[model samples]
Target: MDSFSGSSRGGFAPRGGRGARGRGGRAPFLTKTRETNPDLEKHPLGCLIKEFGSPDLGLNPVDLAKISDCQYVASYNWLNDEVPTIVIPGKPPQWTPLQEPQRLKEDSGQYFRDPNAAMYPDYPMAPVVNAVLETDSEFDAARTDVFACGSTLGNLLRFARGIDKAFRFNVVVIGDTVFFMRKDNDPREVIKDVRGFGHTFPEAYTTWEHSVKGSETHQRIIRYKFGGFSCLVRFESDGYIPDSSAVTNTTPANTAVGQGDLFQAFQGATISQQPTINKLGSLKIKQGGSPVPQKSIFDLKTRSGKYKKDIDMSDILPQLWINQIPNFIVAYHDGRGLFEDIRVRDVSDDVQAWVTDNSDGIRRFATLLDKIVDIARSNSDKLLEVYCPGKEHLEVREQYGDGAHALPADLRDGLDGSKDGDGGDISDGDEYYDSDEYGFDNRSDDSSEELDYTACSAHDCGYCGKCTY
Candidate 1:
């Protein structure tokens, strides 16, 4: 990857006459609809335990090493349609340097919506599985320990460090891999209305400089080893910088399908004219994008310059560490909307420093993940819920009611250990909640103390509710 170039002044370059087009025009805001998963609310909490204690700073820190460099396993972009249309291997928006200060519109419409479910309602993890199978024929799902999205892992990290308020997610042991599915009150619930330029600034600053024009969101999957567990992490990428030296235009080798077969499969593939729902409930795969190198990919943010506050690298490092994003761009705007102080930084070193500094928290996070996986595997049903009812402790209980499966039946059958019998009952030493009601309010009586959910973004903050942006 090329080193960062010094800052320069210029007007936003027009993207016309580009070889390929992208989802063009201002990005569309999410709207209210019935696309939310109904089963999310039907999940009744089962068992609760408080075995895992808080991070013990007195203990020596453990090493957290990246066994494998972050690789782009798969990507897709959300298109504006009555029914969601996602183009696989979707191109991320390109960073277009700004030459002149520009006034952008404040964000409007729904503040939060789970694009993963909205795009692939039948099986949200279908894209990740498909991409892995396509790119690597020898991919062993049974050998992998954890498959999760950045948000799910981020929530766990916050819980391990005792920094986040409260959250809940589903844990299903499919095959040998334990899948962590993020659960919100409503999959498409509007947390609140947008208030800042966090959305609009990106629309004005970045260009989807490829055939995937008009894409609303871009999601990517990566694989790595952490804490003795192989993890396949899916995350929403903000965009990528075009760097020929760091990025490859060819698809990964798929030995099972024949060398270059996946590339041939995607050749000339365009966005579907209509929603292409396959048997697995995934959208039709398309072949127009190059696999962006992790080095060229970046995370972006926008903040107010009125206070002249410096963006805290610490607050953002945890997120970048989870995604392994190498580049970071933070644009500062005066309260109104004129962005002038735009900083494009290479945060690879900063992230490493954060890992060393937060080793205790990371060790605890790894242990928490191992405990959850054990609890899920111990249950005969192989379905469990991880609920954190505040900064206190986390509960791992059997999933009850009409809880949904993580993936479709056929895909589950393909996994190596999917049919494994229940290991045994969870240990008797585990604790349980005696309360009849499983409900807990996450809000505070003082409105001022309430978190601004709108400030959270799937890519930058994973909707952790801690970001001031």
Candidate 2:
């Protein structure tokens, strides 16, 4: 078999249609800068060079992306391209390079994994602590949980926050598990590995457990010290069931732990939901059922069970804010004076930049809060007696019924806003909401707090009152 190697050895007369034509019926020349990827240019160039047996191969460069499969073959190496040149009989040699095809650059936002990648990061991007979950498992360590994917860090935070909206929580990337431990592996040494989070494991939760192969397995939940007024949720393998060996398959870990279903079999007791939190920080029944609805923030479906695949929560928050706040400007700056300003229509850019610059801070903040919450809960079991504010309490006595926190009238035409008698006229894509008709007492209540709603529609906000607005 002839080696596919393109050689400096053979030469053949150029055939018609082999090279693209120029405006004046000549062989078009290619410059190095003609292609963004040098490899794209080199592969075709090498093929032409080998086909015609010349180092000085000239043809249309822009036609690289347009080259048919039969005309081009990719190189395995950087430039030692191997290609077989076939000569067609009776075709006259003629050459003129083709014009460069116009191509648009891909949006850089596709690379960001931050949930708020569509919004502003709480802090700047420089202080990001990449808390990677490291394990010594015989199989790949990352397969233990989705959070191990690194890309799902933001999703972890969002899920944790949504689980309990009453208080902020930090996510402790629970490192190393039983699967990663050898019989000779010291549990204490494994516990020490929690230092990767820049904190020492708490003496109390030095041990944890897991459920694998339909059996309850013991493991360690490395609790590190976290401070501040929030809760700590361990992102561990308590509910993670390995579908297969990570060594054999490099699939991401899928958790059996549903959102908001915490403490099924972990060290920490489940934070019980209280009907009404008293001033003394105790749960006191407030008679009728709690007003706040319970639902998952990560659920991509509507209340009607319609899933909007294109709508990502990260992308929705900014749009919701834009709808309410007029004259909003989304801006991006990279310290290099490359300032890109976008309006509401192109607001996605602003969110992407914010996420890129601040994902580290958000993750760290969640971790720190988790540590603090963990320590507090350990020291005082009383802290566990948390008062669920019975959904988010609106101190404001609005005549508009409790639906004051409902979706915008226009967006809620046939939804909650509609049921509340505030349905607006949806004509020509314009909606009008009447405060008087809808029961909203626009008259500012000196006592009322801000409105709270996940969508500008309806669903049970699982969080006590962590509405987006």
Best by TM-score: 1
Local accuracy by lDDT, each model: 0.54, 0.17
Cα deviation at 437, candidate 2, in Å, is 69
TM-score of each: 0.72, 0.17
Clashes (candidate 1): 14
Error of 1 at 21 (Å): 14
Q: Could you tell me which 10 consecutive residues in candidate 2 have the lowest summed lDDT?
A: 3-12
- Those runs of model 2 whose alpha carbons end farther than 4 Å from true positions after fitting are 1-212, 216-220, 223-384, 388-469
- What lDDT, from 0 to 1, does candidate 1 have? 0.54
Estimate, for each residue in 57-80, the C-alpha lDDT of model 2 and write its tens digit: 122122221101111000000000
Best by lDDT: 1
